[model samples]
Target: MKLVRPLPAYLVQRYHGWKATTFAENKSWYRRLAEDGQHPRAMVISCCDSRVHVTSIFGADQGEFFIHRNIANLVPPYRPDGDYHGTSAAVEYAVTSLKVAHLVVLGHSGCGGVRGCFDMCSGHAPELEEETSFIGRWMELLRPGYERTAGCEGTEQRLRALEQQAVIISLENLLTFPFVRAAVEEESLTLHGLWNDIGSGGLEQYDPESDDFLPI
Candidate 1:
């Protein structure tokens, strides 16, 4: 017998109904999106964690934000790659092509990527030495955070400190991009740092006021 996905009939019907409206009957909504160039108001850099989908947190519509996701949500210092700079390419496009007015780095609580980078720094993950590719190269952006917060009192405290520091690193990297920095200098762009606490269902903004995260 072929395997079948177990489903409640009502849920199946509702799901199909919504899918039809979102994709079939409502296909024009998406068609128009592609037809018209995307003009999102913000460019958000976030982690690839499934738990921290920023769109769900913000109730964003189809084209409200341009998104870039990477391990621990890093933004590398800009350099001439001689070719493709995947994350940096997204940043350039968002600032130059899309011209989004806001650039945001969305960090999250309990980020596994940050912990892995920290562990790699500790020689806990010896396999890191063998992997001389994308992950190894990318994790460079978070090393400063791992080093800075390693001495924090507890595991949770260390993680929070590292997470916050990672956000700042990304902000600095964003400034290294010529287009992004130009936009900021010209007063056409502003940047924000967000910490999403998944367990608490709370969003925190970096309160420059007290230099802490505060509920948004």
Candidate 2:
């Protein structure tokens, strides 16, 4: 109904217009998984931005990746009473419940949420208070990047640094989760950092090999 109906404008406009290849398969898949259980290959922590889709970016099939999205793709330091734990809850479910081995933190360039941290540009999204608070707090995790790149470049450079910082923040917060931490310590799970530049269709990865973000 949600997919067929036009009541929700976003769905009608964005999804209903497209030819859904997975709709039929997704219905059966959902029923089958609900009856039994789900076993996804990986878990992705990504931004709420529609352009940075994890599925199409990685060519993920049905039940391939469990995704959690939030503004700027933040993972706050572990706190049970964080008021808004929607992001963390999804992480908990992905790690503890699903036991996904590969966790990917996905960031992207030209992120409004990341730019909103400093209000370098106008972010008129009043409904995103949690993200407003979160971006403010989480950006601190990128202080080294800000410092390293400060007073040295244009606005675009700073924004790129913030995108990179988001990846670092997500990885750090993942370590704060006991389930995720234990899995990593036992060598059962591995964490990855990624940045997607939507404009150029460029995918940059955190190459530990080069100790820098590199084109992939």
Candidate 3:
């Protein structure tokens, strides 16, 4: 608790500035959201990368999307091991309680987590190979994704492939949850996979029929 403290001066200044501007302009909308609670139509699972801004990309308003973020935007297959499951817990709440109509697995280029997974799997990151490495264990969830892109030509191509694969893997894992599967089967929920090129600002969506990512 010693490390926890009040907001820094710069952040406090920015917060007040936003409160005086963006917040002031939408006070009524904020008040309604606070009173009625959120009922977002979509749930987005995206990477923890700071550069990948989900709300900005969608031009979404506050409470428009229920979002969960983690390393590489990875989703593990449903496992009822009775341990701490942050991402799974969020997905459960979004699907069961929030009843979000859409579930989006979003990935992006130049993701440090995806690069870490590629390095670890390629025997380049020994630090991540340690059993106690939390990131390593988490990145293991995307190992199968790396395997799928093993035949890719260049390192960049392989890494990019893994990035897209992260989205595909998460989409596949979403179906492992019984509630998610049932919702999809009943046409109550839809799953989507998306990858972004950070530099170019280009978005690609996974097409199940074509089994490839296509420009959206």
- By lDDT, the best candidate is 3
CA lDDT scores, all candidates in order: 0.85, 0.78, 0.95
Q: Write the per-residue lDDT of candidate 1 for residues 149-206, one digit (tens) a residue.
A: 7679987788888888888888888898888888999999998999988899988888
- Candidate 1 vs candidate 2: which has greater TM-score? 1
What are the TM-scores, per candidate, against the unseen true structure?
0.86, 0.77, 0.98
On a 0 to 100 scale, what is the lDDT of residue 25 in model 1? Answer: 76
Q: How many pairs of residues in model 3 come into backbone collision?
A: 0
Off by over 4 Å in 3: none
Query: Mind giving the per-residue lDDT tens digits that candidate 2 earns over 19-128?
Result: 36556546776688778777997999988998887899889876789988888887877888848788789988988889898999999988877777635323443333
Candidate 2: segments with Cα more than 4 A from true spot = 1-31, 120-148
Higher-lDDT candidate among 1 and 3?
3
lDDT-based ranking:
3, 1, 2
Question: What is the TM-score of candidate 2?
Answer: 0.77
- Model 2, residue 54: C-alpha shift (Å): 1.2
Per-residue error (Å), model 1, residue 191: 0.7
- Best TM-score goes to which candidate? 3
